[model samples]
Target chain A: MADFFNIIFSVDFGYAVLRVTTPILFAAMGALISDKAGVINIALEGMMLISALTGVIMSALSHSAGLGLLGAVIVGALVGMVLAYFALNLKTDVILAAIAINLIAMGGTVFVLFMVGGDKGISSSLASKVLPRIDIPLIRSIPVLGPILSGHNILTYLAFLSVWVMYIFIYRTPLGLRIRAVGENADAADSVGISVRKIQYTALILSGALAGFGGAYMSMGYVSWFSKNMTAGRGFIALAAEAMGGATPHGAMFTSLLFGMFDALSNSLQTLRVPAEFIQMIPYLATVIGLVIYAANKTEQIKRIQAHQNREARKGAQEVKLL
Target chain B: MFKQKRLFELVRTVLAVLIALIVALVTILFASDEPGRALSLFLFGPLDSLRHFGNVLEMMIPLLFTGLAVSIMFSAAQFNLGAEGAFFLGGITATSVAINQSLLPVVHPVLSILAGGLTGALFCGIPALLKVKWNASELVSSLMFNYVALFLGLYLINYYMRDVDAGAMVSFKLADTSKLIRIIPKTRVHFGLILAALTVVAGYYFMYRTRWGYRIRLTGLNSSFARYSGIQTASVIILSQVLGGFIAGSGGAIEILGMYRRFSWQSLPGYGWDGIIVAILARNNPALIPVGAFFLAYLRIGADLMARSSDVQSEVVYIIQGVMIVLIAAESFLAHYRHKLVYREARKTAASGK
Candidate 1:
């Protein structure tokens, strides 16, 4: 226990938490944006998966990491558009459409990977490029803070930076207000001259692009090779985080970091006597528990508000009787 | 009028399948060196051999269970995705019971299957319980529970049931008494086919003929109205999910006993996800589940044969399944044709009345 505490307090562990949180933060931000627009992007997992493969293949073919990232973003947006076409235009259930996207991604990514790299499991044969890391000049000079914060992958910095950008976009921009208005009440938004469908489309496309960055980070920076189902359940975890965060950008960032800490701990704990499977189950288990707690709290809040409203109504009735 | 509507649905389904096949052919042309061979094999290979046809039937058995399970749950408007985990753990539970040497021969498999079904119900019940008690989203909780079931099942296999001599992460061999009997002479098709058929009938009866079933359907169609009508929607939700899990669990047990000698699954068998597709194709109708299951099984066997004989991979079938599901579930896919037919009928009726 003493050793555990020591490890938890170490700068290395803090650094590991931030490193692991990057992709999840990106995906959670994506979930947040679309969820705020009343269109939950359950296809974030599929989008991440396909984008991961696309990033690897495009980087291998073009010999440029930036181009690979761009390609991944484009494919992600296209997938989002496909989902929009099916759900919005063709009147399919959005959840069912997302499930189809997941199924397609599960098989299609492996098929393409095998065709390109002659392997069904991993892209080790492909000469893929990895995104570069950056060391902050001023921050790097600090002692403990430098080790925990500086000299990380560029995507990691961008993932953190995106929180601020999302905050501004969601809280300040006119388009963001329109998206919120559409989400709050589509009929009312339409009455007020807002095109709910167009706002939702924009939200979903932006959501997919954020998930694309997460996928590129996975294949390019988090690790150097793309593997089958490499995104694992992070996209789902991001959904839980987004919900727990109340669908806010900064809140999602914090929840993502919390889940990422558990993930980093799981990875670090593998050297201990505990079984690897149990350790690996930690992040997923934490997600379920977190969801339950969040739900319970939400229910309690609703009950309190209802109680207050009832009390106010009784007071109004009593004043009427007195009059 | 009902007949016409059914015919329209049938036509739409046929159109969706045709479009999916065309898309699959285009994909094969791009991916396969010999597109002609791949396409031919994919379209006709399952019909070429009796054994292959038996394989299709064998595959359909598990699908039938899952499809019916999903149908029941979706009927109650529950989106519990825990069927996969339930199916997986059901197999584990059955394996545990099947390896016991104390039970009688004929009664052993029955008991084992029941045990598996019970385990599956409990597995899926957690999410339902949480949703009712804490207002959690069943969809998210069930998805999370699947991973929990997977890891817990793995731990049980590794620590409690590991056969050291097997040299792999597998449980002990199931006793001969617990093994399901093969129904056909030359094929591996087992008695699970009969059980699956029975389940389909029972599923249909439970959904359409029972008061509880009525409540479930009403809740699914309009929960607010169901609540106002004094139906216990919460219990209905839980009941439907538990029943679905029971069917899925039984399917897992039947699959393990009929197909394998030992409990050797290291990953979640994807039958549960396939169940979702089957349910969608059948429009959540229990009676049509067999048709959907058979269609999927035939396509899968044909794809497998194509992969074996040609350069094209079998994963192409997933692309077809995805496309088919999207097209079939899209309400507006053939809406214009249906509308035109309805308008013509209305005009004819007006003219006759005049």
Candidate 2:
């Protein structure tokens, strides 16, 4: 227990939490955007995988972090177009399509790795560029909070700002209303002359951008180099975040932060003398337990709803008979 | 008339196979492979020697069984991807049982295999229960559970089964009687092949020949209609998942027993995803599962051979898989294209009449 406390309060642990959550938060916001628009974006993981590859490759070629981020966004958009084509136009099974995209990305990325660097798993050299932190002079001087807030990679700020942007896009604007309408009732929105497919396509593209940005964070910001399958199921974790956050941007941010904290805690547990494998499995275990509990709660809600309906019907029948 | 439909079905299957081959050939060429050599190897590699041919058959057994498993569950309208998990756990269970054949000396090996089968079914049963009890999406739940089972299996092997004598990650060796004998010399083909075939045959009768099959199919096609038709759709759906889990579990046991001396798979065996493609390729026809598995096995064997003998990377086959499955999912496009072609021919005939 003392071991746990010492690790938890360590400066390194707090900073690691910020770093871990940054990519997950990016992916969660991306998921939130498309899910709000009625398309279930299961390819978030694939997008991140490819984007991470692209981010690293571009960084290697150009020696610029900005290009790495741009490369990731473009890669994300390309995959998004493929997904949108199948989902919005071809009218295939959405989840299955996502699965296909994932398979392709997995294989394609590995193939690219071998073709370029002559390795299956990772880049062999350490000369590739990585995103560096920037210090805001004013924020750094303020106190304890400034140190926490100021020294993140530039993309980290963009990730947080994206939450507010996504909130506005989902709730404030006319297009947001239309996207929400499409999600709630496609036929109703179609009747009102909203193009459900178009909205879905656009939302998916935006989602791809955000997901790609998340990948960029992984390759450039989180680590200085690329590794195979290094996103390591964070994309799926973002799916849990989307659900836990109530499918809203604000809610998703908090959930992502919470997951980030759990991830940080798990990472720290290593120093706290927990077994490495058990610590590694924490987020996935948390996902299963969290989902089961949430589902059970929803099922109970349905039962309560049915019971209330029965009571209301009984009351109405008795009143009519009395009248 | 009989020949016409038979010819059409043959043509359709042939067309699909040809398209896959052509795409593969074109990719090999684009990737700077010796097109002729790659093509020859891909086409004849599996049949080049008895060992490779046998290898294909051995690979086919698990694919056939797991395909039927997925087909059976899908025909019940539940997407439980837990067969992969079931297969993984089942392999470990089979290995464990085989390793301890001497300990349970009095018990029949038959009973031991049944225990292995039940262990696999139980692995899949968790997701089935989650779906039935919690209204959880089986797809998500099953996918999630695969990781849990994977990690747990890893932990089990690492902590308990890892042998100090073995240089790397592997389990304890099985007893002599525990290993499934290869019936053909130099061929990987074993009695498990027959078992796999029997499983498919049984699945056909289960889905199409039985009353219970009708209920499951009805529920799968339209649960609301089945419910209105007074069929217990929920129970049928849940039952089919259990049955599907059982077959997949058995397939895993068969694979481990037949292929390895120990349950040595440390990660996901790709049989489950291949099973999905097989199920799709069969169009969920239980009778067609063996054929689909054979085709897939042949392709896999061919790709490996092509990669070994040429410049083409083996991962290219995965891209093909993704493309093919996604294309298959667009069933409406195929139907629409066929409809248009038929209509055009009819118009030509009418104009000729005029």
Candidate 3:
């Protein structure tokens, strides 16, 4: 127990938290955007998986991390557009379309990997380039905080920076308001000349791009190589975080940090006497618990609002009777 | 008129399959050194021998169970994805029961299967309970629960059932009494196929003939209307999900006992996701689930054969599955043709009446 606390308080753990949180934060923000636009992109998992491999292959081939990132984002956005075309234009169920996308990504990645890497599981043979890490000069000189916050992967900083960008984009922009309007009531938005389909398309594309960054960070920054299903359940966990955060960027970042803490702890605990499988279960278990709590709170708030409305209606009736 | 509609649906499904196969051919051409050989093997390999055909039948059993499970759950509009978890947990539970040395001869497998099924029901019941009581999204909750089930099952197997001398992370050999009897002489096809068929018939009866089924159908069609009609839509939702889980669980147990000598699954078996494909292909009809399952099993076996015989990977089957699903589920895929047929049929009906 004392050792556990020691590990938790160490600068390494804090840095690990930030490191692990990068992909999830990006994914949650992506989920938040599409969710706010009323077309939840459940294909974030598949998109991330596809982009992760794309980043590895492109970076290996081009010898440029930036080009790889660009390729990943482009592929991700293209996938989003395909999903949009199927869901919006062909009138397919969005969830089912997302499921199909996931299946394709699962199989397609392995197929392509074997074709390119000559291996079925991992891209060890490919010489993929890793994204550069940045050191904050001033922060690096500081004490405990410096070690925890400075000298991280560039994508880690971008993951944190994106929260602010998403906040401004979602809450303070005209396009954001239009997305909210479309989400709140598509018919009302349509009547006012807002094209719901176009908004959803834009949102899904942006969402996929964000997830693409997460995927690239996974293969290029976090591990330096691509593996089968390496994104694992992070995309789903991001969806849960987005939900718990009430579909807001900042809220999602915080919830993502919380999940990241559990993830880091799970990683650290593997060195101890704990069963690795049980420790690995913590993040996923937390997600389910977090979702239930969020749902309960939402239901409670709705009931309270309904009760207040009933009281106001009775008061209005009483006033009419008196008159 | 109904027949016309059914005909159009069949046509659309056939067209979707053709398009999906074309996609597969293109993918093979790009990936395989010998595309023609790969394509021929993928199209005809499963029919080449009795053993390969038997593999298809063996694969069909689990798919049938999951397809029926998904069909029931989707029919009630409950998108519970816990069938995957339930299936995994059910296998574990059945293994736990099957390894028991004290069970009677004939009744052991039956008891193990029933226990496994009940375990699945309880496993899936968590998300349903959450959705009913707290208005949680069953889809998200079930997805999370799948991992929970996975880790918990692993822990159980590791601590309680691990056979250290077996040289891998597998459970002890199941008791002889608990092993399902082989039904075929030359193949691994066991009594599970019969069980699967009975399950399909039972599932069809339960979904189409019962009052509960009617309620579930109504709720799925329109929950608001079902609620207005006092159908207790919440319980109906939970009931449908639980039933689906039960069927999925039974399928997992049967697959294990009839197929393997020991419980050796190290990850989610993915039958649940395949269930979604099967259910979609069947249009969520219980009666048609077998046909859908058989189609998927046949495709999978062909892909497996192609992978063995050619340079192309079997994962191409997933591409085919994904494309087929998208095209079939698209409401507007062949809308122009469908509209034309409906219009022509309407005109003919009017002329005939005159």
Candidate 4:
């Protein structure tokens, strides 16, 4: 237990946590944006999966990181186009469509991976470029905290900055209001100038962009190569994080970070003599518990406040009678 | 009324098969370097080989069982995804039972099969119990339980059932009496195929004609309405899942007994996911399960052959499946199939909610 406590601050462990958190944050925020617009985005996992493969394939061919990243975005957008076409133009079930996307993406990635590498599940032989790391100048000189704060992969900083950017976009922008309005009541938004389909499509495209970046970062920043279906279940975990965070930017970030921490701990927990399967079960189990608590608390808290209000009103009534 | 419904069913089945065919043809063109003969070989190729035909049946039996499993449960509106885990564990349990109780009795295989069915049902029942008691979402809990089932199965196989003489993560060899007898020459088709078909028939009877099935279907159509009618919705949901688990568990048991000398499946077998597709294609109709299973079985067997022949990965079926599932979910095709029972009922299902 003492050794376990000491290792929590270790650099490798911290980095693992960051790595785990980064992919989920990217996907969750993407989900958050779409969901805020009232368009259910279950396709985030599918988006990550296909984009990851697209990033790998492009990087392999072009040997350029920018091209790979761009390639991933395009791939994401194409997938987004299909989703938008169905959810918007076709009037399909959004959740069902998302489930379909996830299924296809899962199968499609493995297929493509095997096609290129002639391997069953992964590709290691076709070496690809990863995202370049950035060195922030003065931040490295501060103290023990400096090492923790500075010298993260460029995507890490971008992931953190996305929260603030999204928060501003959600609260300060006219577009954000339109989206929220659309989410709140589609018919009302439609009665106004806002197009429900347009908002859903826009949110989906933006979602694809963020999820694509998540895919690129996983391949380039976290690891050197793409394995068959290597996104594991992080995309689903990201969705869970979004639900736990109550679909807010700050709430999502907090839960996303927590999920990432658990994910990292699971992988590293084996070193601490925990069973590998239990470690693997952590983040997923966390999702189930987190959702139950978050959902249950909403009802419980509302009841408490209502009870208090009733008590206050009764006291006022009694005072009036006495007077 | 019955004639119209039958015609609608016929049309839907044709459309589903045609969609799958088109996808297969497109895949073949992209896959083959020598497209002329290879394309023909991909489509008509499975029929030429007795071996491939046999392989198709072997594949069909497990999927048929799983498809029936899913269709039955989905009829009750309980989307228990735990069948995959149950099937895996059930296979292991059957293997373990067969290996240990070799000298017990003449009815050793029957007992082992029963053990498999019971364990699988119990594995699925845990999630159903949670859903009934805590108002927990079965989808989430069952998915979680899948992992538990997976790990536990691995543990059991590794620690107890493992055949030391075998190469990798597999189970011990079973007694000679436990090995299932093949029904067809040169095919792995055992009595399990008949068992699968019987289950589908039983499933159809349960879903369409029986009192308990009426309760399950009514509860599925609308829980509030079912409850108003004095149905025990919670128990029906749990019961359907248990039954579904039993069928899938027996499928796994048969898969172990008939297909190999020892238990060899090390990881997830993917029958459950395919079963999901089969259920959707059948539109959750129990009667269509056999057709759905056979269609899936053909695709899998044909793809396996294509991969082996051309060295192209069969994983490409996923892209095709993704496209297909995406299209299916879109359901704009319903406009064309407006005459169908399911499409009309689904429209009413949507309308009633609104």
Candidate 5:
């Protein structure tokens, strides 16, 4: 217990939480946007895996992290477009299509990795460029907080900033309103002159780009090399976080931080005598528990609403009886 | 009209397969340095010999079970994808039973297989219970449970079943008498194939001939209507998922017993996901699952052979699988032709009525 406290209370642990949260934060944001726009992009896992490979390969070739990011985003958007075409136009089941995309990404990445003369499991031969870390100017002067707040990958700050940006975009922008409108009721949105399909396509493309950043960060910001299946269900965790946050940017940030804390704890626990598998199971178990609680609360709230309506109806019946 | 609809389904399946093949070939043409050699091997490798044919048959065993499992769940509208975890856990649990040398020789494998199926049913029942009680989405919950099951399974193996003398992370090998005897002399083909075939027939009969099966179909097609019609939709849904889980779990046990001497899998074997694809291609019909499974196994073995003999990567099969699933699942891909055919049939029916 003392060792646990020491690990949790340290400044290094704080930094680890922030660092680990970056990928999940980006994915949750992406999931939030697409889910709000009426499409649940379960293909986020595949998108992230593909982009991780793309970002590594591009960075290796061009020696520019920026170019690598651009390539990843483009590839992600192309995948999103494919999903939209199949689901919206061809009338395919969205979930099935996403699964296919994921399978393709998983296999395609390995195929390309081998073709590029790299190990199927790891892309260590490539000298991939990593995103630069930035030290916050004013915050670095502080003693205890400096290390925690400063010297993070630039993309980490961008991930936090995106929450604010997403807030403004979702609430203040007309396009965001249209997207929400379509999500709530597509026929209603169409009646009001908004093209539901077009809005959904746009939402998916944007969502893909956000997820691409998350993927790129896994390879370029978190590590300078790509590994096969490195995402390791982070995409699904992000979706869970999004659901936990009620598909809002602010809520997603908080939930992502919670999951990030669990992840960091898991990492810390690895040094202890505890078996690693149980620690690794923490985040996934948390998701299941959290979702169950949320669903229970929702059910309770619905029941309460029904009971109140019943009481109101009884009261009206009694008044009529008195008359 | 029913005949025409069946014809349309067949055509769509053929078209989807052809498109996937063309796309896979084109991918090879671009990626492979020795495109000619790779393409030829990929196309004809699985059919090269009897041994190759046996390889496909061996691969089909696990898929057959998982396909039937997924087909049952899909027909009941459960969408519980925990079969992956069920398969893994089933194998592990059965391994625990099999490694015990004290059990009766004849009943050891049977008991182990039963334990696996029960464990799988229990694992899959969590999501079903959640859905029944709280109305939670099974897809997400079941997916999350898979990871939990994985970690638990690993912990079980590492703590209780670890064989330190064997390779790292390996379990103790099952007793020789407990292992399933291979049916074929040279090949890995075992008595499990007969069991798998029987499972498909049993599954088909259970879903189509029984009153409970009728209720399950009704619930799947229209749960609200079924509920209104006093079908007890919740129980039907829950029961089907439990049954599906059992089928998948047994498949895992059978595969391990018939093939490996020990539980050697490090992660989910992916037969669960492949089951989904097979289920889709089979149109959720148990009778067709074997055919779909065989076709998939053929493609996979062909890809493996190509990878071994040439410059082509086996991952190319994923590209084909992904493309094929999307195209096949796209219900409206041949909408124009389907509509025209239906129109012609409807006109003829109208004339007959007149």
Candidate 6:
């Protein structure tokens, strides 16, 4: 218990949490946008993976990190478009289509890697450019906050900034209103002359772009090289985070942080007597527990609503009889 | 009418496969310096020798089990995908049981296999129970459970069953009595193949020819209707998933017993995901699972051989697999052809005016 508290309260642990939260934060934001637009983008994993590959290869070829980031975002949007085309136009099952996309990305990356004379395991041969880390000039002067807030990869700041951006976009914009309306009631949105499909497509594209950044960060910012299956189910964890956050962007942001904390804890726990596997299991296990708790609360709320309605109905009947 | 429908289904499958093959061929043409040789090797490499043929059959063993597992649960409309974890835990659990030195010879393998199956059933049951009780999403929960099972299995092997001197994460070797016998003269194909075949047949009979299966099918078709008719839909869903888990679990046990000298897998063998593809290819039919499994194994072995003999990597098959699964699963893919056929049938029936 002492060790746990000591680790949690440390500045290093705080930094690690922010570092670990980067990819999941981006992916969760993406998931939040797509889901709010009535499109469950389960292909975030595939989108992130393919973007990671594209980011590395493009960066290596162009010798420009910006171009590499652009390439990944483009690929992500294209994949999202493919998903929309198949699911909406072609009438494919969304889940199945997403699964197929994930499988393709998984294999396609290795195939492309082999084609480019790169090993299947890692992209070590390529001297790919990495995203720059930013140290805040003003924050560096702070006594305790400096260590926790400064010297993170540039993407980490963007990931945190995205939360605010997403907040503004979702809550303070007409387009966000349309997206949420479409999710809540597509027919109603359609009735109001909002093109439901068009909004969904836009949402999916933006979602893909966000996930693309996440993927790019994994390869270029989070690490210097692209490794096979490097995203390692972070995309799914992001989905869980989004769900646990009650589908609100701010909620999703906090959930992502919570998961990131668990993830960092798992890494730190590796030095302790605790089994690493068990420690690694914490985030995923938390996802399940979080989901169950969410479900139980929803059920309780529904029961309360039903009881209130029933009591109102009984009172109305008694009033009628007295009259 | 039924025959016509079946024919259309067949055509659709053929078209999907053809498209997948063309995609694979295009990939090969771009990836390989010698596309012709690579293509030829991919097509005929698996049939070049008896041993190669045995490799296909050996690959089919686990696919058969996992395929049937997915098919059974899918037919019950439960998307519980814990088979991956179930298979992993099952392998380790069976290994733990097989490591025991006191069990009778005949009962040893049986006990181990049963233990593995039960462990898998229990592991998979968590998601089902959660879904039924709390209305939680089965897909997400099952995915989480798979990771948990993976970590738990690894922990068991690392702490309780590790053979440290072996210099890897492998467990202790099984006693000779627990090791499965090779039934073929020169191949590693064991009696497990026969058991796999028998299980497929039994699964078909159980699912298609039994009353319990009727309830499951009805539940899948419309749970509300099944409930209206007094079916215990929850139990049906849970039971089918449990049974599916058992099949997949035992398959894992069979795989380790038949092939390896010790428990060797450190990560998922991917048989469970392959089973999903198999289930899709078979259209979630128990009777067709073997054919689907065989076709998948043949493709895999062919790709493996091509990778060994040519410049093309075997991962190219995954592109084909992805295309095939998406196209086949897409309800609107080739919808016009089916629509035309159904329209013709409707016209014929109207003209008969019976």
Candidate 4: residue pairs that collide:
none
User: Which docking band does candidate 1 fall into?
Assistant: high
Docking class of 3: high
Interface RMSD, all models, one decimal each? Answer: 0.9, 1.5, 0.8, 2.5, 1.0, 1.0
lDDT of 4 by residue, B82-188 (tens): 78887887788888888874455547677777888888899888778867765555766676677667767777777777778788877777887887788998867
Which regions of candidate 2 are displaced past 4 Å?
A125-127, A136-150, A272-274, A302-323, B1-17, B101-112, B338-354
Ranking by lDDT: 3, 1, 5, 6, 2, 4
All DockQ scores: 0.81, 0.61, 0.87, 0.45, 0.82, 0.77
DockQ-best of 5 and 6 = 5
The C-alpha stretches of model 1 lying farther than 4 A from their native spots are B351-354
**Superior candidate under TM-score, 1 versus 2:** 1
Candidate 4: which docking quality band?
A: acceptable
TM-score result, candidate 6: 0.97
Model 3 lDDT tens row, B6-113: 989999999999999999999999999999999999999989888999999999999999999899999988888888998899899999999888898889999989
Q: Of the candidates numbered 1 and 2, which has the greater lDDT value?
A: 1
Screening candidate 6 with a backbone cut-off below 3 angstroms (N, C-alpha, C), the clashing residue pairs are none
The alpha-carbon lDDT assigned to residue B230 of candidate 2 equals 94
Worst 10 residues of 3 chain B by lDDT: B115-124
Candidate 5 per-residue lDDT, tens place, B9-114, comes to 9999999999999999999998888999898888888788878888899999999999999889888888788989888898989899988998887799899899
Residues A31-57, candidate 6, lDDT per residue (tens digit)? 999999998888999999999989999
**Best of the two (2, 4) by DockQ:** 2
| Predicted candidate 2 versus true structure: per-residue lDDT over B53-111, tens digit per residue | 98899889899888998898888888888888888877777676777746543343444
Q: What's the ranking of the predictions by TM-score, best on top?
A: 3, 1, 5, 6, 2, 4
Model 5 chain A: ten consecutive residues of lowest lDDT: A113-122
